[model samples]
Target: MFNSLISYLDSIRERDPAPRSRWEILLYPGVWALFFHRIAHWLFGGRLFFLARLVNHMSRWITAIDIHPGATIGRNFFLDHGFTVIGETAHIGDNVTIYQCVTLGGTNPTNGVAGKRHPTLEDNVIIGSGAQIIGPITVGERARVGANAVVTDDVPEGATMIGLKARSTLVPAETWLREFIPYGTPCDEPCEPNSGDRAESLERQIAELRAEVEALKAERRGDQPHKMSGTNC
Candidate 1:
């Protein structure tokens, strides 16, 4: 328990580039909210439903974050500018980073279904500000949801979900994680020089990766070179 608390503090400090003292982390609303969440979750697990909800409500009143007691959040989770709503049955994995106004909400509020209604985030997922991940979809490991992206479907591992409906593109999230992108901005690669659209560049890269994989497979089987497709290729 002590180890978990220490790790949580360390994670917030490390991920946030601000030079504030470690003592300031102790006063963080997210820290306090998570602290209350732990106690509430313990009570909920013990079948003290009313008591658990009471604590949950208290935490929400104190901190603007609204995380249900039933939600299972893993270690090293960071919530920036909290107003994040994690619904019941939402399962977040370790090293997840969520910005303000993000919602891991349910889709079928009136379906009367018995199973899980909230989304499940795999390890190292990063959700940008104002992003909404609805339903029981699984956000794969190391995936990223760009700012304000409404994701109702499952996201592939390492993919970056971007754009506002008319031009949503999925690229390798791991690609931009290598470079430093400022907080609250759309996740995009700064190194790419082509037309300034990071998604286009990543799409080209994805196509190249596919071609390389095919080439490698063909080499092992002693087959002829497979033709590569795409604008750049």
Candidate 2:
């Protein structure tokens, strides 16, 4: 158990550079939040609803991070700087990193039944500060949600999402190859350039498809003339 705790702190150190030592990481509210959550979750699974909620409320009061006792979190989940809210049906995968003021929110049920309402975050995913991931969408593995982005749909694997509606930006090979990207954004260039390139690429592919269709039409026209001449003969 001691070794596992050390491993958990070491994982946080790899993601965050501000902490000088493992002891400093122990002071982090996120770590404490997780510790409280583990006990709460165990109680919740055992049908001890009141006790689970009690622990959850206490953890939120202390850490300023609101994670429901029913939320399923995997190993090495890091909530950097707190102020994050995770919903009841949220399922978090291993090594998922979420920044301050991020929300894993749920949508209102249309059928009046409470089911899986929150987002499912896959392994190695990073969510930036103030980013709102709403509804029951699945954020694919290694996906990055940029700061202040509002995402309502499923994020593709290895994609970087940005902007108000959260569109995917084309990440450079170098940026994609990196193990971790701070704030889930590329440092060197603005997202507009990548968006523009993606737009141009899509337009080029459409033009190529049109050209192929025109070539096929011309070939059919030529064959029809040859068939008519043979019939006349």
Candidate 3:
């Protein structure tokens, strides 16, 4: 368990430029969420459904991230920000990175389907902030789902998915990494306007991510954004 914590912190430090120390990492909601999720997932696997749900709720309260206890997440899976939701049947593989306000959600009605209603993300998959990957999709290894993309289909290995329609472009993941693009693929959104402090920058990123999520939701519904008060990406 301690090794896992170290691995999580190391992964974050390697992939993100945010954390200044392990002490600061301790306060991150993602860290707490992943920690308790391990216990919750164990309880779920042991068939202790009631206890698992209780742990899930507690984790949600503490972390503000809703990861169903039944979801199977592999090593070094980092949920970069809070408000991320992973569905019960979702399976995330090793070294996956998911940013804020993303959802690995169900599309089919529970009453209508008997099996996996969520997505399976393979190793090294990076889901951008505010992306929604719904239904029983298989996102292959090293594939990237862009910010605000609504994916409902299988993604080929090393592909880059863009937009609500999820138009996929097959690019070798190795080549992309060789190019040194941050976050696996080139992002669509512009860089956040330089905020003075780390806290301010974090808050600004969250707001941008949230707005992108809302805009994507609106696009899928074929309507204008409901909240007209703020600038939306």
Tens digit of per-residue lDDT, candidate 3, span 93-122: 999999999988875442454588788999
Q: Which residue pairs does candidate 3 place in steric collision? A: none
Q: What is the C-alpha local distance difference test score of each model?
A: 0.81, 0.90, 0.82
Between candidates 2 and 3, name the one with more favorable TM-score.
2
Structural similarity to truth (TM-score) of each candidate: 0.68, 0.71, 0.68
Residue 194's lDDT within candidate 1 is 42
lDDT of 1 at 161: 99
**Ten contiguous residues minimizing lDDT sum, candidate 2:** 181-190
Per-residue lDDT tens digits for candidate 2, residues 148-189, read 998878999999999886445555576555554423433233
- Winning model by lDDT: 2
Model 3 TM-score, 2 decimals:
0.68
Q: How well is each residue in 1-233 modelled by candidate 1, as lDDT tens digits?
A: 87877777888899898738777888877788888998999999999999999999999999899989999999888887778899989999999999999988775433355578789999999999999887788999999999998787789999999865323334456644434321322322243344458777889999999999999997967643333334336
Q: Look at candidate 1 and tell me the lDDT of residue 227.
A: 32
Name the better of 1 and 3 by lDDT.
3
Error of 2 at 94 (Å): 0.5
Where does candidate 3 stray beyond 4 Å?
A: 109-113, 166-233
List candidate 2 stretches off by more than 4 Å: 166-233
Cα deviation of 116, candidate 1, in Å: 0.7
